[model samples]
Target: MYNTLLLLLIIPTLTSGQPGKCDQTPPQATVLTPSENKGIYTMTIDMKSKNQNIYRPDQTYVLIVTSNDVKRPFKWFMITVEDPEVDNSSYEFDHRSVDVGSLKTLDTNRQSRYSERCYNSVENTDNTDKYRVEIHWVSPKQSDKKQRVRLRAMVAENSEVWYVGENLTIELGKDTTKPLDSPPFPPVDSCNLCSEARYEVIFKGHWSRMSHPRNYPIKPDNNGYSHLVGASHSYKYILWQEGDKASPGLKKLAEQRDISVIEREIINAMSVHNGTRTLIRGKRRDHPYMFEPSHSLFRVDRIHHLFSLVIAMKPSPDWFLGVTRFELCTELGWLESHELPLYPWDAGTMDGISYESATSSTQPVDTVDRVAVGSFDKESPFYQMNLNDLKPFGHLQVRRLDVYPLVGDDCVEGINEHEGSQEQEAGSENVEEVIEEPLIQAIKQDPSLQEDNCALSEWSEWSKCAPDTGYCGMGTQLRSRYRNDRKVYFETYQDQEDFQDGYKSQANMAANCRQKQDGALIESQNCFVDCL
Candidate 1:
């Protein structure tokens, strides 16, 4: 019989917390009697009756269907298998697979009962074992109202599987049918299987005018040419309090880079709706003074959206680069990228005397400090630039692009809208496999094999003179030192024989530091705390 149904489907199917194979007997089925009128619901199953032998072929069958008192939930369910001696059947729901047609809808205000599972097998061809299994239920908001159903059937024969059917309960109340005074509405504690989601907000902008600091301005002047020429971003879902006050449309979009009075008065009065603006087109030495890299796109619905950005570091009077109220849905979910490192804030309303001073600063607004590189000194005009390669000047790639189906109404299709041409074809195939690696062709044929013989580390023992501050007075009692081993030799003839034997040779050390003892291990102790 198909090799006893492939040795009872290769046994080992014991779970309900194990232990079963007929010893704890329970494997039989025959539950008919189930029907409803107006709101449609039906059920039937036989599987050869005669004290329910369960059409053997080394049995294994399970069917669990549920629905209790419905009025607006129970969108669909179906399963049909009219015999000719069946051989296979499968159905599942929620965890997907109801023949993939419709099955993902169960939120009668967060589940009030909905279950499905069917598995039937009869092995090799049809041998007349009499079969029939049909089940269906649909509710267009309870078509004309009336529902109740519950069926549980499980069977597993020798080689194990058993829970044996018949717990069947059915009702289709239009006028009372009884048998369900409770049980079937325990499932509400946030079941958001992705209620609408879409992200994609790339905005990359790196500024440079020989990295800033030459007569600065490229426009907007009274004398001193302020030069950070372009930027404006906006987003809102409100929540910015810290002694609030700053409005006047955020000081005219931070000292005159005007964003239409903060998009009609503070992002349309704290937007939860109308508020969208993102314009970042850098470089301004006058007339689109060219300097590239700038992007923008934003959309977030719920998950407490909030974003704000502003840039302008022109001739200097009102300096800028402020980003407040970030929060792009956290709690481990919606934030794929967020990099901010543009510092220089001084919206104290305007003050200039350098960067070509167009002068203006009656001082007053306060909070000024954060524009460094020794804040332009070497005769000002922004000297030896390279503020850490312009400190990450704003990068915010949020990429989520579609995810809505936890009980669909059809809306969740838009996979990465060409995700920047699939990330520029995966960054040009990872820069052509990192320029054909072999460590970049051995550092382009020995560029001193990119030096790095690595060694430095041998201090250790000297840590007991705490009290640097648990103050009583003068304080300063420190003594600390560590490192008893550090090695690295990327073979190039063992780093040129450990750089010509400057170390590494106790069979190339590192066996507990080959009985320690190397050079440069200074440890000092100079403390003094007497005041009180």
Candidate 2:
């Protein structure tokens, strides 16, 4: 009896001082099968984990299985615990791999392939030192969410195992039935068929005029047509899976072929939060500026409008002849009474307005007389471009195109019209449109009306008539003011030919000029005020 009492005391001491569980953690897992899954592929995995100390044959846990791939890192999720006690009803159990009808095959277990796997495995006898589970089947294809047969295992550790497979589901996607790289473009109709390189160059040539943070690319869902280089609805190009993300194949041909393609986004507009300015690229005249490959969040429908103009000039004998085309893309849904990025009045200044300031009282008229849209020859130096070699990710076939041509003073002819003269006495419009009468008609014409005519040597004596109204009077007024401002500040504008560039400079000038309190020309609070 004394020995037994000594043994009981010794047992308590040994239990308190003995080494505890060495393999208390679960095992790491590795999936070995299913390198690819498109049709009838199978998935298999080998997992190992450990548990020690108290061992109960009835204790159960679950294992979650998952995989990593290139297109998608994780695709499947499968559970290991199949005990009736573990409610598997909450799981997304798709039995597409189950055989039915004549496709059924004889199985010793008579259970569907996917439901055939044993829930748990014991290392030896009724208990297990580690768990290994495997499942096989084909995923369902009809769902829009593309829920695939993914695998992610979790073991309850008998303690943590209950919640391991709960609320775990793998997202699936449709198979790539038609692989890319099959020349997914329409049949060519013209010589050279405008290769992707040429298309990109043309797109660049026309995309540069847009000023962003004000003239951003519109979202496709936005109402109205896009007027910028690549903003139009029909202006999308193809995405040659292997080519640059900005390749012109994805844009419309007319837009991709034009000379310029740049637009602006406004940071602050009225009380509506437009976020910040983003430069959207790849838009064309009369097209919708729907999507910008560079900036994904910018949507056209969220904005009010987009404006674009293209000017083409030719040097004539008397003046520089030019054709200017203006276009606007607007929406009715988002328009409000609040101030907007000024259209032409404020936009044409090219010098004085800050994108942050919305108080400028500039109004856009229907006409813009100073700017013109012009056609260009592909061979012209302005259209000439170099290849961009260092594109990110070894993409973006950067090919430079010619900048738009700038018409000089020699090619410009100012119109002169008499005030309120409606009758066409000597009908000749501006100097650019004036036609010279034949010398023979002047010499042989009736001598009475000869009072209006002069000698062949004095052909300049004949004066042309004026129209009832001035040429786009409102437009002329606005353009004249802008031109006068630039002319008066010639010293301030050495190389400032661009309207937007000039406007930025003007914004700086206004900030520096200040009202003096004591006849002193000291700097005022304009800079600080402007910032505020």
Candidate 3:
């Protein structure tokens, strides 16, 4: 009786979970497996990113184990990444590992595997934190082709009751199919391709997360198209072309988003390579942030009507999207209003699979090439076989705004209508069609625009009694924090932002930053004339 009482007294201080559980099969007996008693509780296993359900074989991912009720935190858990191809043992009692077709010939008799993988709740900690546990699992690299791996886990509310989560199957490969590498881009219509003629045009860039939904590279921070750099020059000059090597200037712009180098190339073209024919001055406009269309005014004459422009993709690997060698004038007439998808093109300058992949220059120089939908290679960020059509990284739409004088202060070169001036096409019935610069300006100046983007920094420190005139009667105090501060102040940004990790404007990013100097910080408060 003393020995029995001593055993019960000492067990509480030992390791968690049932003892001797590490030993699978007993001498000449079957291995005992636990049963999943459900109905009263629920549990689930999920991925952290939640962007893609598919994972590359052999890659490591974070799996989150969660329960529906925070009040019932899991007291113990066991997880396994299994190859479904292998068969597990059958037991008269309902075993989830067998029901889900997993476990797969895994030897449960191994003490080391069980002792190392099983976990139990700790003392003196928030049980809620244990409710959501992150498990890092590495997938099997050599699973049979097309076979998926099943993720199985069991969570115990305590030693007496437990819940077995449904099996989550992850495809061994990136995807079953891939998008086309070279989608058939229709050739430009109207052959009258060029001449000494000129026309003012409105260039609209629609670059958004919708077009390039593949955040797998890295969720883009700047989250917008870089400034525009193009030339209104003769065919004598080429900004970039498919299957051709990218120039040093073009390469720099694609990889670094630096337009100055390419701008110099346009300047040099007039002095050396493609003289006077390169009529368009190499200038870039301010980038549009958060997917807003970037509109610019420019004129291309017949002599320099052969237009081509390149705009970089933020947080990309030497990728840019734009029109190439487009002759504004076709003998038929100016291609009035032309809208086309702007497929991403690789400068072949940087070797990377995603936007934030470490920069590794391609040696021996790779030729510029178009990005095709990588439906097969799950690793490539551009893979889109899984996405619906009509959505890509971006698209370009240009409409003739009006005819420009051969020699004018504007319209002959690339320019941003910063003054919010928009020239409408003459004889056009649709006046509202032209992007109302005034509306954009008003939106920028309007405080209401804050709601969509106006997120506040974490609540500021509560302030002390105000009315310093004498903190005694009818006094009030308030604490304030920043809103849209990242783009408005905390930094020098008229439009775009660049951060090493990512560029999305988030409240957390500016939690410690303030716009106190610029008057962008907004205070939240409530006060009454009558005070205690």
Q: Considering every candidate listed, which one attains the maximal TM-score?
A: 3
Task: Give stretches of model 1 more than 4 Å off.
Answer: 1-253, 256-264, 269-299, 302-306, 310-316, 323-335, 343-358, 361-381, 384-410, 416-532
**How well is each residue in 276-337 modelled by candidate 1, as lDDT tens digits?**
22212222222243233333333343322444555554445565554555555444444445
* Model 2 whole-model lDDT (C-alpha atoms): 0.20
User: Each prediction's TM-score against the native?
Assistant: 0.20, 0.18, 0.40
Question: What tens digits encode model 3's per-residue C-alpha lDDT throughout 1-532?
Answer: 9999999977664433322222211212232344454433432433333546555433345455566675777655555554444444222222223222222112221211233222221111222235555544444433444756556555555545544533322433343442332222323432232223332333345555555455443444454455566655655667788778998888888887876577566544432113223222212333344355554434454445556778887677898877777666553444566666666788988887766667788887788875534323445655433223335555566666555333332333333212111344343335335433210000011223244454655644544434423224544544445565234322111111111111112223344444344444435344433345
User: Against the true structure, whose lDDT is highest?
Assistant: 3
In model 2, the runs with Cα more than 4 Å from the true position are 1-41, 44-398, 401-509, 513-532
| Models ranked on lDDT | 3, 1, 2
Give lDDT: candidate 1, residue 528. Answer: 56
Taking the tens digit of each residue's C-alpha lDDT, what string does model 2 give over 209-319?
242222222331331212222221111211111212222222221122322222221111111122111212322122233222110111111121221122111110000
